[model samples]
Target: MWVLIFWVLVINFLSAQEKFTVKKIVFIGNEKTKKEVIARELSFGVGSQIDTSDLAYSENRVYGTGLFNRVKIWAERDSGDSSIVYVWVNERWYIWPFPILGWKDRDLKKMFYGAGLIHTNFRGRNEKLIFSFALGYDPWIEAEYLNPWVLGSKNLFYSVEVFYQRVKNRSKILEEEFGSFYERHLSFALTFGKRYGLYKRFWGSIGFKEISTTGEVPYMKTLSPSGRDQMFVFGGGFRYDTRDIPIYPSRGFLVSVGYKFNRLVNCDCFFLQGGLEFQGFKKIGIGLIASRFFILNSFGREIPVYSHFYFGYNERIRGYFNDVFEGENIFGGTVEYRIPFVKQKFFKWNKAPLEEFSILRFGVDLVLFGDFGNTWFNREKVLKLRYLSGCGVGINFILPYDLILSVGFARNDTGRGQFFIDFKGGFE
Candidate 1:
């Protein structure tokens, strides 16, 4: 018995120390993206000594770039203790000339429609270019261009955007007294960013905005006495993300910190804002659970109504689907348990003409969720209305282009149930 134990221990030690040199890397199904673009995300390269687990990390990094619909990686070794890494990826539909047809407040009467053209992988280097317009409840035209690797410079990135929009006022008091009114905004911005390794980055932005309203803009809504407000905006931020997938993940976390200021150069409007957000994901048996927490606060003597934080606008407490809250400071958190009903699968249509649209991946997840949030104007009001919370169950349709469509029903502290349809699958 003693002799047998010694041999077993020696075998285990030898296996634990096993390593292989990367002879080369071969990428399949990356017809458009350049080889270097894919290699930049990898943690190891040719001639590097790597263990078996490194291939999984390399695959996740490539997938997190949002460039691929599916990724599979493996290594093949020879008797010489050298191995060839094989990366298999299904590239996404990078160029889209799609029509936009959507409704607000789940009302068909309040619908918006338009068209847009975008190239998500411009020049096959992960640059993004967009041109779009919308008409109806909120009308807007926008153009944007982003290059994450500026001029091939090391880790540098930049973007420019021009936008025009007309939106209806959201103040319940103003809307009830004056009926309905509109605000117009025309703006442009230029931003620069730098990447620190694969999952961390920092950025700064400078922008200008001209804002006006129809039918005598109220003083509470405008920072300028002239009623027409022109302001300069500046912002900076840092982000660190390690999520296994950009769209959906079973593990890892994300951190973001940002600051924004208005009326920096030549305007009367004044507000400084700071925010922090963190999201984490973890596996729970056959499913996964995710959570997010965020806080946004503003400083300074004045903040325009258009800039105030709101719960029912872009973000929401699912139980209060139609209710909107306005405040100078807001904080919130959400938790969800997602169970796969139909796991992700990839398919190809050989008969299709466009290769970009021919390859497809789809899945479905049943999500159980709860959300809690509060909005307050001053320190005295903070946490005074803190009992607001909602819980719900939703079905997430995982589609191509890293998109998720969620439909759910929720109930709040008031015991009122509301139905909701949201994009982003609970996380953007």
Candidate 2:
């Protein structure tokens, strides 16, 4: 009996090391996505030789595309030393005509509403096209187009956007002094980007903006003597991303750097700006820990109120959840440990009102998080400035269509905790 057990163990060990050549590859459930798009992410081709364990790597590569909710890859042994590879994927619905109803910080006075049409996988090639219009606190209409793989552009990517908006200035100083008013903005931009392999990209953009203020306020407008200015925008950036999953990555890091120049075409108002960002994720036991840090600064004559950085407006330090911190420069960081409450999977609801909304992928995660940040004042020594920070716990709801919403609580130096709502990890 001992001899029989030893022989069986030896056979199993030998089989695990065997390599097989792929005779063919088969795919299933990729009805909307093109075959080439899926094949481009594969690590092995039809004639490639691979170990059985390598199929898992291929599965992750396809899943990273953000087009599929579920992906599975396997191999079938043949009579010879060759195998048939099978790849199965569940594609997400491509088109959505959805309504938008939201408020800033749940403030009913800051309410805004709109409707939009989105085609994520436009033409089944991972392109995106959006058309939207909104009415309320700040109303706007916009259109955007993105093509990652242009048909005849040497494998380059491009995007175009145009919009017109009535933007109400969110400056507390302006509102406190002169009173609240609206600004007008009409802008158009074009960008071209190139991806090196899978995880790196470099891009450049150029655009024009015509902006005017209803009220002449300090730090609100460029020097055109008309309370309006026409400016040219130029920017370039580089990125390196290797996250296993973009929405809730468990491992990997993302590094990004960008610089921008906003200059009046005919006047003297201009600003030069640059920013650096780093986000990393790692698995610890059954949970994951993630951290993000970013710094942005500008140089030139004067930083407009609309362009200045702030803690409470566009950004936040957990401790000062309801407070605003503004200055010449801004920097901050956050750390989070996320434990899986419910693993993500697809649920079919046959009686749903819309077919695209029928197949749902919902998940819940419990998160422990902390945040710290401050504005950089030129007059004050950088080392002497005190930073604001806070820590708290929350629940993350991963909804369908790659949306994330958080309900959380945090406390700052005042020892008073504040309940808050955030989206997309509030990383940026």
Q: What Cα-based lDDT does every candidate model obtain?
A: 0.81, 0.79
Per-residue lDDT tens digits for candidate 2, residues 1-428, read: 22233233332122365789999989998899987788867778988989865676668678778788677899998759888999998787778798978765434457889999999898788889999998886888999999988753366899999999898777676678888877789999999998777678899999999888886553345456667878999999999987666666656789999998999876777988889999998666456678899999888776666666777765777668668777778899988877789986778889987555567778888878778888875665889888788888889888876678888888876688898877755353
Residue-level lDDT tens digits of model 1 in 1-428: 22233233332112454689999899898999987788878889899998866777778778878888678888898659899999988888899898989866444456899999999899999999999999987889999999888655478999999999998887676677766878899999999999888789999999998888777545656776655788788999999988777677766799999998888333544789989999998765556778899999988877667777888777788899768887888899988877789997777778867766677778999877888897877644664576478987889998876778889899887889998877757477
Candidate 2 collision pairs: none
Stretches of candidate 2 off by over 4 Å are: 1-24, 42-66, 78-83, 104-109, 151-153, 217-220, 353-356, 426-428
Q: Model 2 shows how many backbone clashes?
A: 0
C-alpha-based local distance difference test score of model 1: 0.81
Error of 1 at 38 (Å): 1.2
Quote the RMSD, in angstroms, for model 2.
7.7
User: Backbone clashes per model, in order?
Assistant: 0, 0
Leading candidate by TM-score: 1
Off by over 4 Å in 1: 1-21, 47-53, 79-81, 104-110, 151-153, 264-267
